[model samples]
Target: MPRAILHLLPLLMLACALPAQARTMSAKIARVTTPVATLEGVEVRLDWPADAATGELRLRAARVDAPDLGYRFRALEWRCPLARDGQGGWRCDGELHADGGKPFRLSIALATGSTDAALSQGKASLALHRSAATPDDTILDLTRVPFAWAQALSAQAWSDGRLTAGTLDGRLAVRTPEQRPLRVDGTLVLADGGLETPDGSIAAAQLGGRFHIDYRKPAGSTLLSLDGELRGGQFLYGTTYVVLPGRPLPFALDAIGRDGQGWMLPSIQWRDGAALQAQGSVAFAPDASLQDVDIDLRSHDLSALGARYLSGWLGIAGLPDLEASGALDARVRLAGGGLSSVDARLHDVAIDAPGKGLAFTGLDGDLRLSGGAPVDSELRWRSGALQGITFGAATLPWRSADGTLRARAPVSVSMLGGQVRFDDLVVQPPAGGNGLRIGFGLALQGLQLGELSQTLGGPAFRGTLDGSIPAARYADDRLDFDGGLSMQVFDGSVDVTALSMERPFGVAPTLSADFALHGLDLMAITEVFDFGSISGRLDGRIDGLRLVDWSPETFDAELHTEPRRGVRQRISQRAVQNISSVGDASFVGSLQARLIGLFDDFGYARIGISCRLSNQVCVMGGLRNPDGNRAGGGFTIVEGAGIPRLDVVGFNRNVDWPTLVERLAAVGSGDVKPVFE
Candidate 1:
């Protein structure tokens, strides 16, 4: 048996033990009343002399209905001292219990000018007074009720989630003169309340609030005026998280709801560290879905707007790391459940971050916006920086309407060994349930590749990168470049096209592109790589190349020597040995093998390589047998073409990418020296 059951067994046995010959009587009860609930089908037992004015009463009921609260109790029990009042009345002091919890101390009096009751547990209590009037004229007072009890009373009020704990102190007046829509005038103070939804999208660790609410209903319409002060708590609503203050965040609203018209709020005012004012109305469908919304709002501080309300919004927008301050005044209007327009201005603003994500200093701007139309604005910044790229004072004349913000003309920034120019740039903020959009034409001029490589901590290739993007756009958290980017390297041009990116600022960013290398001077490439000497021109291409989290994952690549009339196609002995190591192959020369190192260089008719990588393996291939499978079988990587004829055959058709990377690293770091076979 379970240990908990064993512990409770003794208690159960003691409760069931009844004294022999004890006075016990059972009565089928049709109804009984309490301040909170009414019981039916009850059985009662009295252990006392007949006709006695006082007795020990034991009452039990299987169920109780609390119509006022829309709740039903499965088990109800009462044990009390029953006494007869001198004036044709009865009073009882008892312990009332339901659902196996610690009983509450209850005092009930009947016919004492109607009825009086006080039900209490711990520090909370429910005090009630009921007037013994006709059904239509009766009235029940339920003002000093515990929040927990009220929650249990109306369990069906909200089916999606439940209120866990709270203390409520309030005053309510209920009148039932003649079948009218029950009106409630009350003030409720809620403290230490916690609520969580089933899906966890909306939750609060602890919530505290004080509100004065007036509720009325007439002709299928419900109207309310609520004024409240929100106190300290940690709250999460969808992707937004906010920590409220322990003191007061005052707010007021007047709203009304009609059966078919949904709900509307005409006036709202919120005052926290700052003021946020809004005039709005919204409609919801029968099943509680938004039907329509119209609102106009104003703010004085952008940073405060985020800190107090949309705390998680900026973070999700890739601007989490920010320190912003200064005067911000903005007006926003929404209609049809969408952002309709915005007119804003900022003065003397400064923002920065230790993460270097983004920073701006001395910012002044004006923004005019119209939903799905064009807007006009101007912005000027004293200095700004992003990813270590610094810019001096600059101004941008922009137009924002049509769901997008675009610069009136091209804007350029000089940074990090390059000049970045933006033409026809348009930026669309993520709003109205849409992702951010940025479309522009980009030109990068004279970007020093070595400096860029150092900045990105990549290979140090010496060159000038000059490229233009005819059209580039970003949407749905992804960015794509339409044209190609080219860089001068090894006396040749390296061109990149079909470039795209996914989740640029999110987890596991992915990038894809294609590259073509043409007229690469092998001698210059070998010199930069410290891979001995080679005199030839090379051509290569990488198609369908992809990188996940900055790691190569897929590519179809090939590199080969391009033969030219009168051009020297020679490979140094050291270069040959390194290539052999890289390919995991051996040199096969038709010359004296023992004297292979005697020659400083050897001529090669052709040199080729290919790798079709997939599943972490590079399916390696050498020069193809363009002429009848090259005499017998296998590839001819290096065809001998001189007195000291030599050739290197790549024996392994499948090489692990990691092994290849390691070999390259070893060669680059001078760890792998040339060795004769």
Candidate 2:
């Protein structure tokens, strides 16, 4: 044989020795347990020489599951040809898939004699391609697999999980086409239960919730939309309670967020039974601080809100015994660490609670919080009334300073055709090493005493109260009012030296006043108490008159009395008889006694008395007509009815205050009822 023929024979032998088959090895494996290989018959015809080339080879699989390799690939198939490039390098081309076992997902092309592929699962996936010439390292690409199940996913605890007919029919999709970022879209049901993140365990029970969440990959940040109805469910997120359906509830929400804009809930609505409906929108900045909010709420009964939303805040599981109903609409905005303003309207407010002794009817009002700008805001109220009493319009203004709030407007309330105004309401809370200072003034004008008395648990008093208290200081919750008042009807001028009130505007304001009454008609004053009158000019001065709890404490007083000229003092026969019996004065002058009796009260009377304040004693100048009778001697004293001398000396130390109040009140009403004590 020739030498060339020998070489050709070797090549033919080599070609015949190779397997001869031709067909596409398109295969797929998913969730496979053990390793398996499949090879179809292939056609191969080759004439091998010193530097011969290998034809192209392609590997295709919908998804290859290689547990041993910790890899599960979807649409992973490749094409590689055993050929030398002009630069003597190798490459390949094919396609790759994530985890789904579908068709050719990615396209790949290669010019290499060898190819290696693997798909992994559990937490991560890696793809590698290596060559003999470039054997120093392998081309490695890694990807993280995100949990896409809509059941339960939380960083804290195992979420409540459920796959009911409602949830199962609901489609949920979570995709992370890029590393370290994920996007979610789906719909859930109220019957789908809730996801609970307790201390450690993430579990799920009968879920009654609807939620959508989009988060970054590897799970750090998120924007969520949650809404649903729950009848009776418990979700414990570090003592956080979410309202559930079952008893009657409906809720919905829409939320969105951007990387720098932060997480925000743009819309929210809730309804509980037939009780309340609340709708609001909230926005937040990147730091999770409040940006703006608008809330509108309507309730059939505010007292019934306990079973719905307010129970948690009141620290009571049940509602108060007060029955109230109203509808409210409000809009609030905040930015740069301060509240911008709010606009609200209330309609059909009615309160009726008998046991609580509260009654009100037909109340409606419009309230504006802050205006549009962030500088100064005014709150105005219109068409407002409290408990059937109509009131004039009012406004309150607050200005912002260095991220804090300071009131800049006076507060006013009008009722019964009168107005009460408050001014200088400044609250400068301590900020940056500066102590906060507060100052304000109050004025009451033309307030009808009859209506006020009725509201204040009195029968009625026909009069008016007009006064002004200007400027006060508050530090550490202690308030000092420094002002005075003057009135004509009280027939005197009262000087308010100094008074301090703790928690004023909440409880009653404590009062300390000094009063001096000049020569005023005592008979006219007696008409106020309905006591039988004695015509005379009376004068007195009360010093250190302090009241606490609306009850007088230090009552130091002095009194002077004298008969008025030309007025026959009608000392009653009863007064003549009572005075004759109580005081040890004998009727030495029957003629003068008759004169006093004829006057129906008293005549030529001069009495000096000192009340030892806390001891409740009137140390009187012996009961007799002064100048006409001598003290400690036989004196002519009128009898029967002056003011009743109850021998109440030292009564303060022994008086049962509550019983005294009852008796005194009865006496003012002209009832001679015995004291309850």
**TM-scores of all candidate predictions against the true structure:** 0.78, 0.49
lDDT of 1 at 588: 68
Clashing pairs in 1: 373-401, 373-402, 375-400
**Which numbered prediction scores highest in TM-score against the true structure?**
1
Backbone N/Cα/C clashes per model: 3, 65
- Per-residue C-alpha lDDT of model 2 across residues 465-524, encoded as one tens digit per residue: 678888778765467877765443434333444567643322344566677666656566
Model 1 TM = 0.78
> What value does the lDDT take at residue 365 in candidate 2?
58
Per residue, candidate 1 scores C-alpha lDDT tens digits across 364-481 of 9897767877778998888887656565677788887765687998887776567888899888876767878889999989878777676666667788889899999999979999
Worst 10 residues of 2 by lDDT: 1-10
